[model samples]
Each structure stands twice: as C-alpha cells, then as structure tokens.
Target: MVDTKLKFGVHIRRAADKAAKMTTALSRLMANTRGPRASRRRVLMSVVHSILLYGVEVWADSLSIAYHRKRLAAVQRRCALRVACAYRTVSHEAVMVVAGAIPIHLLAKERKEVYQKKGQPGTRATKKEESREETLGRWQEEWDAAQKGQWTKRLIPRLGPWLGRSQGEVDFFLTQLLTGHGAFRAYLHKMGRARSPMCLHCGDAQDDACHTFFVCERWAGWRRAVEDELGRLQPETLVLKMIESDRNWKRVATFARAVLSEKRMELASQGPASHEGTSSSEED
Candidate 1:
C-alpha cells in the first residue's frame, strides 16, 4: 500500500511540475504582449493562472489531510511541495491582484471580438481552436452572468475577498445568496411571498442575512456568540458582513443552502403557517 501510494505521489508530482512549467510559459506570454497588436494571449494566460491558483487553494487543506496517515504522508508531502513550488511561481495574491485591478468587462469584449474574427473555414471546431483571448472573454461573461439575478453583488464587498477562488466559485456563492443567505427573502417579502422577514429562530425585528445567521434565535446560543466576534471585525459590504461576522459562515452557508434548497421548504414549513397565525392573532 505504501509503495503504491509512493508511486502515485511521484506521478502527481510530475503532473504538478508540468503545470508549473506551463504557468511559466503563461507568464512569458503575458510579458511578451506589446502595443496596439492586442495582446490576447497575455489576457488568456492571466485567467488560466487565476483558475489554477483557485483550485490549489481550495484543495490545499484536503491535500494535506492525505499526509495525516503514515501510508499516505510521504506522497502528501511530495504533492504539497510541488503545489507550494507552483504557487510560488504564480501566487494567488498575484492572480487576485491582477483580476481585481483589470477592467474585466473590457477584457471580455476584446476576447469576444477576437474570437468572432478568428472563426474561419478549415479551422478546428474545438474550443481549443479559439484564441486564448476568447476563452477569458467567455469566463468574464460567465462571472458577470452569475452575478446578474441574485443579490451577492451588493453583499460581497463587505464579505471581503474570497481568496484563491475562480469565477466558478461564484456559482456556489450565488446559490447561497439566492437561497441560503436569504438575500431573496426581501424580494419574497415584497411580493407577499414570505410570512415575515423577521427571524423565526430569534424573533429579532430586522431579519436580513445578518439577523438570520448571526442574531437569530434559531441558531441556539452559539450563533450569537459567533456574531459578536464577527461584529468586532465587521466586513465592508453587507453580504460579506454577514459572511465574515460568523466563524461558521461556511457551515451556515451550507445550512442556508439546505434550508433554501427546497422550493417550498420555507413556504410549506414557515410561510403559510406563520401568515395564518398572524392573521388569527390580528382578528382577536
């Protein structure tokens, strides 16, 4: 078992090493771009690097876990070293800085135009045949589209940077925003869809995302304690404020996802019952 694990480690290391070599190539392509010629290759490389780093950061902990047992520790260590080396070449911070600093919309436009022009006969239909510029442009579109309907856009700034994440990560966050975070609660309330935006768990008057996750009664005593700790280091954006205010944000987000997951969970469980209860009390 140990020998097999060791061999697997060797294989993984070689693969990571190859990725690092490719990352260097990306760096060179980025550097090689010059004036007015529209450096599509450079832009593509940046997007690729960001995605690579995002995956590495997310799995870094799990990857380390494999090292916990003696049978796999050596392989884990080797893989870790290879990952560390690759990241050193193209750090997550660097990728974030580049992503944040650039005008993503404009870059996306450039990429689209480049791809449209490159569509010619005798060319391979595979997406790989498309220029690097087009690929990143598509990614930008996806990120923007993901942000469109839901409310996370208003909340993420306060939430702080989601370090080492790709545009794909936005989908999970978006799911939280629309369903679990209850950002949609207000919309539902406005449409007379929900019984109340107030916390059923805590009976707090203001039951937005913060109240539901941090100040609500539903979480038992633990949520409030976590909220107090977060309040001390409140984030800048409202959405992120809720996220950062809790040490259990990830856990809570998962719960929120579960709660919001069912189309009628809130409606069937809390909505009609609370609405009727309120009406009966009013009549009395």
Candidate 2:
C-alpha cells in the first residue's frame, strides 16, 4: 500500500518550504516599502497565507501530528518574525498575537466557519460584479451604525501614517475595536457567552475598547509603560485628531499592543469558558 502518512509528511514539508520562500520574498518586499499596516497585512495574508493554505482543507487534520505540526509552526514563526521585524528569540505565539495575526489553526478554523455560513447580517445586497472593497464598506457602514448606540461618534482612531508598526499590530487593534470578535467582556456578553458585560479586571463598569485601555485597574502597571512611550497618559477617549502622523500612530499601536496583550492574558487565566465567543469568528 502507498504510505499515505509518509506522503503527507513530504507534502506538508514541501508546502511549508514553498510558503517559506514566499514569506522571505514578501518580507524583503515589505521591508523597503511604506504604507498602512492594514494594507500591508492584507497583502501578506493574500499572498503568503494563500500559498500556505492552498490545499490545507484536505490535510489540516495532520496538524495534530507532532512532526508536521512543528514544521508548519516553524514556517509560521519565521514568516511572522519577518513580517513584524521581530527577533528570532520571541515566541511565535507572542509575535503573532502582537502583530494581530491569528494562530494558524485559528485561521484555518475561521476559514471553515466562513465556508459554513452564508453572509453577514444587515448586509446590503450587491451587484454580482461587486468588488471586495464595496462589500467591506457596506459592512463597515452597518458596524458604524451599531457603534453609534454606544458612542456619540466613532471613538476608534482612524488616522494614519496608518503607523510604522507591522500590519499585524494595526490589524489587531482595529479588529478589536470595530469587530466584536475579541477578548472583551462586552463582546462576550453581546454574544450571550459572558455572565455580564462588566470589566473582569475591576468588575465595576462595562469593559469596552476605550475602558480596557483607560479604566481597568488591573492594567495600571502595563499602562504606565505604554504612557511612557507616548509622553502623557491618553485621555479616556482617543479621537483621531490626537494622532498626528503614522509615526505617532505606530507609537499608539505599540502601546495598544502592550495593554491589550495584558487583557488577553487576563482573559486566558479566566479559563476556556471565557473565550467561547472568541473561539469562532461569527458575523455580528
């Protein structure tokens, strides 16, 4: 009989090697270019991941195997390191989390979820010739409408040099703020997963994008480090006007990385039940 196991072993390595080359080439291309992190991140996802997952649906379960899993994980780490311009010593999970790149398995899982679903709710019907940007804009308009209920205006910063940091960081920050799919109690409650929408850290008020950064007492220690990078403590609201350039946004994104990371860790400590909402990427 043909050794299916052996063949898959070979197949995964070949896939990883190809992905590595693309990762390297893309890394080099990204290094010299300038643009918004989200834009670059989109390119990275469009290119590298598209290559890495070309036939993943058929073989994704092999990821449970230690050998194949390690090989692909290495590829992910190397690619992430290149994208973030981070050191080799950093853990891949941390690099990815900081960059806003989801775990490879999580990415695969998200893809499956998308395939199983139809479309986002409240979506405007589009022409068959609709571009991806058009769909995205419609979704954004719907999301912005829902957001108006909470804030008098959109408080999530949308200024640019989009930031000097990698697209992953910018992606992570924007996704957390605009998308309800994140590690926040408000999001969890909205999904009917959490017992309450209050801050797990303080348990006093609704935990939100702004409150997590400005109000949580559990994060005071981490907040100072973020503030030191910024010149002053950011006020409760971070309107786009405060961000002057991409350089300043990069600094803000960095601070965002630090604080949000702590909150992610805190949520992790609360156990698996806390992440029920975050486990799946569902439409709002």
Candidate 3:
C-alpha cells in the first residue's frame, strides 16, 4: 500500500478501511440500544483499534499530516459514537472524551514512543505503564486548554479518574448529561433543530445541561432523591460523588436516565417549529 511518491497514504487508508469493516462486523454487539457499553469499548480497543494501529510505529510520523490523522480518526470516531451512545451531531473531541477513547494521533505517538523504548526497559510492563502516564498527562493538558466541550471539561477535568472508574456505565441518557449534546433544548436550538433554547419545563432559564441537571424544578424529585444520598450536588463535585461508590454511580446515572427520558418524550410531543430569536450567551 505504497504510493508513487513512496508515501504511506495508501497504507493509512487501507488500515482505516479494514478497521471500519471490523466495526461494521461487530455492529450488533456495539448497537447503542442493546449490548454493554464497556464490552463494546473493549471490542473497539482490542479489535478495531488494533487493526487501525497495526503498524503505527512505522507510519506514526506521517500523522503529522492532518489528513492522515483525520482518516484514522474518522474510523475511531464511528466506534466512539457507539460506545458513548451519543448523538451523531456531537463533535469528535467531545465524543472521544465521553467515550473514554484517546485521540488517534496521540495514541499513535504513544505507540511510537513505546516502540522506541523497547530495548532500554526494566520490564515491558513498566515501560508501557510509564508511556501511558505520559500520554494521559499530555491529554489532560489538551483537555484543559480545549475550547469545545467546555461543559464536559467542567464535569471531567481529569481523564485519569474518570477512566479509572470500574463501575459506571455510559448509555444514551448518561451520555447526554456528560456531553451536553443531546435532547437539551439549548443544544437542539444551537443545532437548528428547535425553535427556542428556553426550557419547556422550567421556562425561566435556558435548557442547557447545567440548568436541566441542577437548576430545573421539573427534575426536583429525582434530584432530591440523589441529593438525599449524596449531599447537595454541583457540577464540579458530581463526578467525584459518582465515582465514590457503585451505588453512588448508579444513583447519578439513574437520575440522568429518568430526567432525560422524560425530556426526550416531551420534546417529541412538541413537534417542530420555526427558529426564533437567538441568545447571545452560551450555556454551561
């Protein structure tokens, strides 16, 4: 898969194609409605991702070209969307964060670095662990500085703690809460799918992730149920509380599922409308 100019562009495309085929083959298991998200994530990493990065150490340098990187990223993006059970409209950066999948370019660089450190290692395990730490450090820096997905960044400031969690599951309702990219009137209005950003339930504030999760009175009962168990909740401390225990995680996710399901059903009942005046400020 070499080109006339000796570039590995053809090889990269072939790898992406092969990986995409693998994703399609496992579509049933990765379907957003059915299988376990954690299992889908594992299959993505162990199979599809493995195919995409099969010889990344050699062409890792080629990832400096944005086109090559995007080609591979597109393949990963498809699987990530499934893993997070997120809407197709979510940005690549945001979806990757919610899905707990590393960026393709960074992962390629990590593989290259690990390969370079092959012979000078104390143990293969030790070197690999060190490489992962370095990669996660770089990823955290990027996450902090990123302009998109500001809402998600507020909730998950650090990738390490979120990825380290052994319990919580990612499903459609939870993904919406995590990414701020679904069902919420603010996001739908921004995407030109809704007439207004004002909350149908609250009517006093914009229906963004923050307003719906913490401020909206419509979910007060469910919210109170969670707060009764875990103290008063805020965006900053929500993730901390969620990861504190399996029961806590399930409670938070249950709140998300209950609230978002109701929101989705209500929005569906409203039907479509013409766009109205735009808001000057963005939602958090």
lDDT of each: 0.36, 0.53, 0.79
Candidate 1 colliding pairs:
155-239, 158-236, 158-237, 159-240, 180-256, 201-217, 201-218, 202-217
- Candidate 1 lDDT for residue 102: 26
TM-score attained by model 1: 0.33
List the candidate 2 regions with Cα displacement exceeding 4 Å. 1-37, 41-153, 156-169, 178-180, 228-242, 276-284
lDDT of 3 at 166: 81
lDDT of 2 by residue, 1-284 (tens): 24766676677678789888877766766541243464455466556677666666555552334446666667776666445543344344444533435445545544443433336543333322233334334333533454222331244322122222233344454335433245677767766666678887677668876677666777777667756655555442343423454565566566666666666777667776665324332334
In model 2, pairs of residues that clash are 99-168, 161-246
lDDT string, candidate 3, 20-87, tens digits: 88887776676565677654466665677788887778777643435577788888887888888877
Rank by lDDT, descending? 3, 2, 1
Return the TM-score for each candidate structure. Answer: 0.33, 0.42, 0.89
- Alpha carbon RMSD to native, model 3: 4.1
- Candidate 1 C-alpha lDDT tens digits along 199-270: 555556555544544344554354444445544322233334333434335544444444344323444566
Task: Report the poorest 10 consecutive residues by lDDT, candidate 2.
Answer: 156-165
